[model samples]
Target: MPQAEVDTPLDNAAVEARRAAARAVQTAFRNSGVHAMLEVATTRAAPAVSVTIPLGGTSGSPFLGGTGLPLPDGAGPLQQLLEHHDIHAQVTVIELGPDPALLVALTTGDDALRLAALVIERRSDAHDAALRLSGVFADLGITEDHIYVADGAVQVGDINVQDAITLYDVLTGQRNDAAELDLGDRWDPRTWRDVEKLAELMGPVVSKAAGEPLDCIPHPACRTCISSRPHRITLGSASPQQVLLLADAISSANSSSTSGVSPPTG
Candidate 1:
């Protein structure tokens, strides 16, 4: 008698591979120290699939959400899943430090004075730091932007002592305006297309109070402070990075809602 038909070895391998990749992504997330959430989806008609991973939380300054993890460990497996299914996947990330707008305000012209005030407001303990910063800024007869322009090497007083260190740390925190991506090693034509589509969608909706629009979502509470463009997540409108930032804001807001954390004052 003819042997009963069974699943092909190739099919079995593919299933096993998908499972392994998913497991790897989960493991990576756990080890990455980033508080993030993941979602998986498969589109109709094309049978294409995708994964959405949002990373970050509000551990640093409020009103400012930092750029999330650099290249998360889950990226490799996430990329594999994208290629295996010949579909799209987005790793939405949350910045873990200060908000983009705060950084902008501090690094720009007089915005640093406003940010310094806000910093003191948020963290009353920072008042002394603010005072010291003011003295240094006043003595140098320069704006925070000038200090940043000088690469934090400008001397205000006692060039080799504690004053410089304090100024450096405070200024350095605000001067950071770098962008981070998680495209991984397996991106192909499809991934690039997806990313470009996301960028187009996100450009108009995201908002930044000071500099260019942040490529991420803003927290609902942050709406009061940050000036964004309506905060809508129109598919293909926002890049994966923007969505990730939005996700971080959403998560932080949710957590705050539950934890009784106070919202930003100004």
Candidate 2:
């Protein structure tokens, strides 16, 4: 026996139901809060929603100064400085934003050459400093086992205060003939920035080995480190000072959403 076949089309009700579901999802997504910070530790591209911020989007927020925060010396002159430094320095480009704001991240040579540091742009100073410190163990030379340069997607693995302790132990070792040394110190903006903890720790020892003072300021290489420090603080909530300032900026940027905020009256 042959069965009768039935054809069915969605009624207006079904279409409306589907539309309602989609709208609900869209509304929920729009209202979601995303931290405006990008984590470079991972090799993934930042989300389009965060990147497509308008000139007035993330800029006009009181946090970014109603049109983006000013670099210490501003962008124009800084560009000239960075370009000049790049000529003889180990500086390179890292990330560039839609508005063409350059995100220059740098590392020294010793710090740069490692596969872990390969994830982003590194300044030669770091590598040099790391090597200069490593020079104390120059007898070891660059071994395939100790120092490795990695390519493709590589994870930094677990990094913590304990890691610094391990390096610290190596630095304090009496042998000093060891193949690798870990020199990391405090996580403070007062001296080095994000990637510099180990460098900072190892820096002083290397400086002393090189007969230079830890405070002995080298000729300035890149202002990129200093420029990013504030941004780091702003994002990490590491420093209360930056948090207050950024919170104020966020408040101002989103003043419309903050009904309880009292506007300054002239």
Candidate 3:
């Protein structure tokens, strides 16, 4: 018959129906967790955290409720879904959009997400690698059976619980002023090697104390201790290639969260 209304004209009633449908969909996405994650993932180079199709998340996807969320094989969810899954993890609070407008927008747009970045600041251990080592020693449990000096490296003869603790404090700055130390301007191989070496030296002490091997997060301290640096890793996706950041590298890498003019944040 007559191709049934392929080019139907819109009347006043039709226009109202269109508006209502559009409004409903918008309302569903507004202030939703999926929307919030989408907003943040757009800021980052990665969007897998927000989407389900290989790398595409819908604003109304039920997976956000921890029902059918697809966590990649190796890469886990990027801190945004931690609370949704009832997972307790350390989180770094972040503004949703550009400041001034950032806070206002998140507050008005998606108060449910609350906007934070939960990064891996710690490994799987009783406490943070350094903190655990430091605490064990401070508790007065370990002792050093002997001391060995080779190539200017101090080696414990037989680390008891207390001495292991001492080493962690000495290296990780648990008992020392670590925050004052710097990580240098650039993280060259030499710097990384030095940091690695220091961590290796310090790792054993703490391990003996805690009775397990451990490495602390933001190991920039390991570099400072070994290389005697004074420059911290200025991170942030928009941070300068080499900025003398007053804050930690984790803060610097959030280039998307930066104010202005800075480039290459995280």
The most accurate candidate by lDDT is 3
> What local lDDT does model 3 show for residue 197?
43
lDDT of 1 by residue, 1-266 (tens): 89985433334544454444444443333322222232222222211122233333332212122222223443454334333443343332334344211111011112222322333333322223223333434443323311110111111122211222222223223121211322231112223333333344333332321123543221111234324211121122223333344334434433454566633312
**All candidates' lDDT scores?**
0.29, 0.28, 0.30
Candidate 1 local Cα displacement, residue 171, angstroms:
45
Candidate 1 stretches greater than 4 Å from native: 1-12, 36-50, 59-266
Candidate 3, residue 122: CA error in Å?
A: 18
**Candidate with maximal TM-score:** 3
Worst 10 residues of 1 by lDDT: 100-109
TM-score versus the correct structure, for each prediction: 0.19, 0.17, 0.21
Candidate number with the higher TM-score (1 or 2): 1
What is the lDDT for 14 in model 2? 46
CA lDDT, candidate 3, residue 187: 37
Each prediction's total of clashing residue pairs, residues at least 3 apart in sequence or on different chains, is: 20, 14, 30
Against the hidden true structure, what lDDT does model 1 obtain? 0.29
* Ranking of all candidate structures by their lDDT, best first: 3, 1, 2
Compute the lDDT of residue 107 as modeled in candidate 1.
Answer: 16
How high is the lDDT of residue 147 in model 3?
26
Please provide, for model 2 over 156-211, each residue's C-alpha lDDT reduced to its tens digit, 9 standing for 90 to 100: 11223333233333334423322242323323334333334444444454333323
Report the lDDT of model 1 for residue 46.
19
